[model samples]
Target: MPGPGSRPASEGPIPHLVLANVAKRFPQAASPAVDGVSLELARGEFFALLGPSGCGKTTLLRMLAGFEMPDAGSIRIDGQDMGAVPPYARPVNMMFQSYALFPHMSVADNVGFGLRQAKRPKDEIAARVAAMLDLVKLGALARRKPGQLSGGEKQRVALARALINEPKLLLLDEPLTALDRKLREETRFELVRIQRRVGITFLMVTHDQEEAMSMASRIAVMEKGRIAQIGAPAEVYERPANRFVAGFLGAINLFEARVVAATNDLLTLDSVEIGARLTVTHDRVLPLGTEVALALRPEKLSLARMPDSRWNNSLAGTVRGVAYRGEASDVEIELTCGKIVRATMANIGGARDTLDIGQPIFAGWSGEAGVVLEQ
Candidate 1:
């Protein structure tokens, strides 16, 4: 389990969900689908399992929902071991990517299906279903069948159905993928709002970086069936644990370098890629001549017609390509050493001065802008 500092501020001392040394393997696969994975989730925390396909995020989710059992280790919910619990008996509901609402059933019936199966009173189910519909903003569409609802509407209906059970945790498997891009973006905030209103822990599995970064209070980035890094979105994005994490999060320019000078608070590196010496701030004194890589995000590098004295590092390059992306323009610059570096310049004041291809440019960045990583 992670320390208290890893817990969300709203969480209590006890974790809502705990996975300890969890491992799983398929019958014919050479490697384990989930390997020695462990993490803790706080109560009411909106957490996300973020990774590409075949990274074990979905498998871990299935285990949490009791659809799949771990071959080794244990899963605990609210401090109770879930080894013997079945899917229906577990206090977890899953809203799958497909929504999976019954085509023949009315919206109200679909939302109330779980309660009806549990043999609750008709009046109680109706009342709870009505409240859930209102919560998801589908009260007006309750009488309509799933076939009549829009993609977003069907999604809300499925969400209402899942929440009507009042489960301790909700599992969302690619919850927003079915919607169009604009609608998907809109639903992200809507899902966050609904989760806050319900006040239940939401464990979502997703391959979309934007969805996880925007909606999750914390995210676990999985790679090759193991957690590469786990932290708040900003922390994981800004201070990635390794090269894989830095590259996976977004576009970054990495310069192969070696530590030439080291002090208590500063380090100097000779980078062959940039054809320049780079100075960056560091708290620890690494050994001289240690190989390392300097990582700078595209947004962190500023391009100018002339070198800026304020920059701790600067390199001369020719603009190879320029791409306009509305709010910002991505410029690809080729250094004298033939290394390519990308920089994103904001399109402030509507239309700014544009840089032409093959034009001379200087990319500069402050010492604080770069992150040092082990090769």
Candidate 2:
């Protein structure tokens, strides 16, 4: 369990699903596929499990879907224990990365497959299928086969099929991974709209951090079969728990330092590369002469020809490389002490030959911008 200030496995407001110390391991494997993991999802909340390949996000999703059982601990859905529940009996449905639409069947038949299999009345099934198709904006194309539709259309059919079951929870496993960058970005809002419209709890598994940040109400970042952190997208990114979380989420510059002096909510650290004391805003108390790392975001730093004394932190460096990225230019600087730092400057206008290699510069940042990482 984490404190009130920290993100907990499950905090207050009624959990719709709970996993208490869940664990799983495959035979002949080096370690547990999913270690002792505990998490909770609130009713009608959209949660995302984000991590790289082989980090156990998929295995965890499988356990929730009743496709695989946990070796240890317990799983509960809406206050019911699911240890012995079969896949068909679970109130959940999955939309896979490939969409898995039936190529030969009409869109209406495909969407109604789950209802038909459940032995619902034909008239009732038809009604639900029509509504689902309309919800996904594919009502006019209901009579077409999968091959006649575009890639995004096919994905909507899969979503319609999954939603027709009226499951309490919906699982999406990289549902937009196959689409191009532009369409993937567009579909995130559509998914959010669908989830909000139906008011169903959605647990999605994805390796794309941007996708999760855009759509999920909160995110759980997993690494090596364990959760690294869980919080709102901005919280996890700006207030990272450790070095791993800070570096994994985006571009960051980590500088090793030793504490020199400390006072309430403020501390001074000494780093060889900085050639000066670094000031930081910290809520946690640390003893004198303690070692820690400062996590600095690239965009937080401002480069100038002279040191900006008002800013609390500054270092002299030479611009070593520059990369143009349309809206901003990534400038790589090699400090006097040989440490490399990266800074991103907004390109208000076309900056052709703006910063030449070997040009001397000073990088400055505010004290509150740098996060002191204990780990």
Candidate 3:
């Protein structure tokens, strides 16, 4: 149980769902699919499970959707234990990766299919279907078949169908995988709007880092059937739990260092590459001979021709490559210790004026910007 004032599994003021020590395993598999997973979802919150492929993100979601049962632990929704609750009986709906819209049926019929399954009155079903279509801005396309709609339209129809039932929880499985980059980015906002408007708990599974970071109120990063870390977007990005997460979430530079001196406020580390001293802000006490990894984000570093004395972490390097990304240029620097560090600088004018390729430069960052990870 969550303490008072703490966030629940679902998003809003109410705690609608809870997973306690949920674990699962499959035959012929070496380990569990979901191991000791527990999460509290406040009602109406949007949560995202993010990871690389085959990291048990999808399997955990399936267990929540009633498609798979956990081998150990329990699942509860709104204070009711969901033991053996069949998929149809659970107060949940899923929008699959394929959209799964009926190719032969019109949009209205597809959206109303769930209501029809419950055997609601024809008028009642029609009203709900109309409202759902209008909510998704697909009312004008009600008469069109799935084949007649564009990729985004078909996705909206699928969303409408899933929401029409008014389920307590909505599970989305890579819902935007089929769309182009531009469309995917646009639809993310729409999904957030729908979730807020309906006030339903949404649990989404995605491998896309940007997608998870953009829409999810909080994210749970899973690895090898276990949660590696869970926190708000900024918390996870700025302070990853381990080396894997530091590498997976975004562009990061990991430097191996040895602790030279330690104190309550700061710890000085000797870099293996540049042989210069590195200062870090740490809460956990570190021994003088400890080996640690320092994680630094690409954008946190500034490149210059001379060392910045004010910067706690500074290194000299040779420019490796410069790639223009329209809005910014990615500068890769090869340090004297044979490690490559990347930095993203805004293209104020253009990459043509930015740091030239093969130029020697110095990279510097503040102490607070680097996070020390044990692994």
Candidate 4:
């Protein structure tokens, strides 16, 4: 798999938003805030710019909104160059993390604020505001002020306002950060539903992996001011492009190993981490004795009291801890090789649920359960 800063070829319909060689650098910074990043979004596609704090996701979004100009490269929205376009002139609307709703204004007034600023006809503004309120399911609360609404309600009002202008691209900057856990989870689906209903291309900037994975049709994983990989959520998660992408996206166990054997569609690695030979199904053959990293998701492992013959790889260990997470349990086992490996076991009724700390156990997986990274 390709490592960080590698840009894959864009594949899809004609792009509605095209960013080419976009870069930004702040004064006296050690490195560029955003570096030579290029991406494309098809019309009506929901895309996410995902990364940790200070990885340049927000900077890229700001550049897209025309609030921050790139030091180098070009941005095109609907085939129009945005180099000279100001924030208000760009065919985009940004919903800030703070929601930015007027405290004294009613929901209807807030939703209609954009049209009013544009000096739209009174009848048109009223009709559009009513339609938007209905679309967001907040029509009944139209007379309520911002303070009178719940976090989710205020978010809907903010969304309605952002879409009121009918921008070609909608930029959401941490849209659900203010909501509580349950409300944030509920709002994710709502945002996806609303985006699909309106058929507007949504480009959301968020640090929450679950939010991006569940809502965006595709995600661009950024690291150190550049794109590490861009693909569907499943692709990015299951087949990560590098060690950074694998470990950043979710909980995974990485093991250092060297190629012991290779075939047309498989690889055998002599792993020092587990003190066992690991087998993985891969497309290409690697040279014998070549160093590589083996990555496995915690959920891919199965634990038992005894080694299973069905698994192509197995490791004996002693259970160190088990954390119950309602639907499943996260198990940490100390292998005989002195490595701690994590396995996620579902809470289905079975002997596995009766596992106790410090008990002897065997963790096993099939040959296809792991990803071999060259880096």
Candidate 5:
């Protein structure tokens, strides 16, 4: 339902891989593990399946890797149906979270194991191994065993092994979860760079929201084994389809309202709790008296003591608490309606010095910045 107004060009080429009504279920459970999910990944695209644990993201990835079969629907790669094709037979490789490196084998042997399994000539396997190591910038560590390498190094070796086969689709399962936070952040950029350079299509499964937003060109957000939303990182974050997607992506302030008036580009909603009217932009048609929800991102709302610096929608509140973040501060305000709203303010030009807890202030946002959602 997002992007109804600023529609993108329809003539742009579609993705190379497509999933048509794919569904999966496990025995002994009433619900399906993957519940009728469908999506597409273009050639040389970086795509992410993002969700929390038990959201069916892993199950869908397993199906794509041929570890599990779908109960219905079809999966196509380059316009060819993948009907029960085994993992090895398909032109795809998966990088597991465990890395699955053999402790006894050196890095070179570990990366070359796939080639050896294919019965490639010894010289050919060696040459490919060398190239893979150099691609990952790990050629110097080729002689070391997995036991001697750090978590990040082991992950790189696993990636090199997965890429050695030059699979049409590369599936990564929580590839960076094993590393520390700082290391993971650094590796995400590296992964994106490597994928861009090779021009290979990547399908990554991860529960980290920031990871998906940063590394993927497009993301499919999953919930209860179904796709909740799919779009570019900015689109998904700014124009979520529902309350769940908005809350899951980041911090948000929500208010209950009912449509009091309607127009082509705007709708006036009467907030039940605050006893105020708010105007928002939307293309969806809702009759008057229809209930709706307003979502305001924390960063979009600002606070001030004087009502003269009027925002499009302003409400009086008292500062309940303040949490000082490194570059920004979270200000919690207790509204007159007994609802709490949070605003994030950058600590610039000594702004933090003027703020104090329990001070009465005016907190609001631009009408155009907040999004309206159907109840």
Candidate 6:
């Protein structure tokens, strides 16, 4: 994770967009909306700003669009400072979460509205509009009004409008929020296709972790008006910088650990909660008596009916909770030491609901399963 983090934000070739120590605050507000944040986005990269509502994800996107000015730091796009640039003057376009398309205008007209406002030639606007419609697979519905189109179709229209300007950077504010679950899933792939076709840097703000994981090549997880972590989706999800990022991306079991012994290749920690000694295969030495956190995703743990010595950590427990989720089932096991640990098992060879509530089971995990979290 640390190795992956070093590249996109700091080590890559000159970025297409750079936000350096950016901060913004509202009038008399208790805290800044965006606080001391910096990130670099590569050319033609699909980057996601992911967090809960009011976590400054939307605020960051707004800053990129020039809708709100930052009180501190600077923004640079393609080697140009944006300090004096107005919203209309910037080489960027934003597609809002609402899909702000004109209801009265036809799809083609809506897509071409920006071109008309810019006073481009009529022939060029017509040809570009037609090409964009065909790009989004909406050529047949070019004459349809926004009200007459489905949610997905309208979203395509808004996207076409944004791209018609040929922005160097494109900002998307929860672009898939309006669609149904099925459509949203379908549109995720559609978005990837469209972004690849356009070959433009995409900066998207989304609260959906799955969306970020699936669509973004990299993600910046925001917390309380600041960035908590930024890296490739898998790297961030598997090796989070702290507890907030670890728990925010997905469900995981946490244990407070105290280092009891350390060696060149591993550090052994004692956790009273599980009444077990856990080993971590660490690249660096963990000092003795140091307090740390062990984060284990549910799927990384294995539960079985019989005891096995395959894992460094294993414990006897009783099943407390069970949730059947089609492909896999989540089970909460209460260890004899009065601690609850969750495990997810794929329903492949065995019955879907094998672990009955109150049934005895064994929970186990290898040293590599846990990520030693940072404070």
Best model per lDDT:
4
lDDT of each: 0.90, 0.89, 0.88, 0.91, 0.88, 0.89
Give residue 334's lDDT in candidate 1 (0 to 100).
95
CA RMSD (A), model 2:
2.7
RMSD to the true structure for each prediction, in A, is: 2.1, 2.7, 2.5, 3.3, 2.7, 2.1
Report how far off residue 285 is in candidate 2 (Å). 1.3
lDDT string, candidate 6, 1-375, tens digits: 123445654335556789999999989989888999999887888999999998988988888888899899999997799988999989999998999999889999999998998999999999999999999999999989999988899899999999999999999999999999999999999999989989988999999999999998889999999999998899999999999999999999999989999998798999877778999887779789998988999999988888677888888989999999888888899989888888899888667448789999988889888898748
Mind giving the per-residue lDDT tens digits that candidate 3 earns over 154-201?
A: 899999999988898999999888999999999999999999999888
Residue lDDT tens for model 5, 1-375: 123222223224654788999999999988999999988777777888999899899999889999999999999987778867888788889999899998899999999988998999999999999988999999999999999999999999999999998888999999999999999999999999999988888999999889999998888899999999988889899998889888888899888899999898788999987889988888876899998999999999888887644567888889999998878889999988778999999888565366788889998777688899894
Pairs clashing within candidate 6:
none
Which residue pairs of candidate 3 clash? 8-40, 8-42, 9-40, 9-41, 9-42, 10-41, 10-42, 11-42, 11-45
lDDT value for model 1 = 0.90
Off by over 4 Å in 2: 1-14, 349-353
Candidate 1 backbone overlaps, count:
0
Q: How many residue pairs clash (N, CA or C atoms closer than 3 angstroms) in each of the candidate models, in the order given?
A: 0, 0, 9, 0, 0, 0
Q: Which residue pairs clash within candidate 1?
A: none
Query: In candidate 2, residue 311 scores what lDDT?
Result: 88
**Cα lDDT of model 1 by residue, 1-375, tens digit:** 233226555356566789999999988999999999999888888998999899999999999888889999899888889999999899999998899999999999999999998999999999999999999888999899898889999999989999999999999999999999999999999999988888989999999888999999888999989999999888888888889888888899999999999988899999876668999987678999999999999999988999998999899889999999999999999988889999999999576598899999999999989988874
Model 3 residue 10 CA deviation in Å: 8.2
- Per-residue C-alpha lDDT of model 4 across residues 20-64, encoded as one tens digit per residue: 999999999999999999987777788889999999999999999
Q: Which scores better on lDDT, 3 or 6?
A: 6
Residue 60 lDDT in model 2?
A: 94
Q: Candidate 5 local accuracy as lDDT?
A: 0.88
TM-score, prediction 4: 0.95
Error of 5 at 264 (Å): 1.3
Instruction: Report lDDT (Cα) of residue 172, candidate 4.
Output: 97
| C-alpha lDDT of residue 160 in model 4 | 99
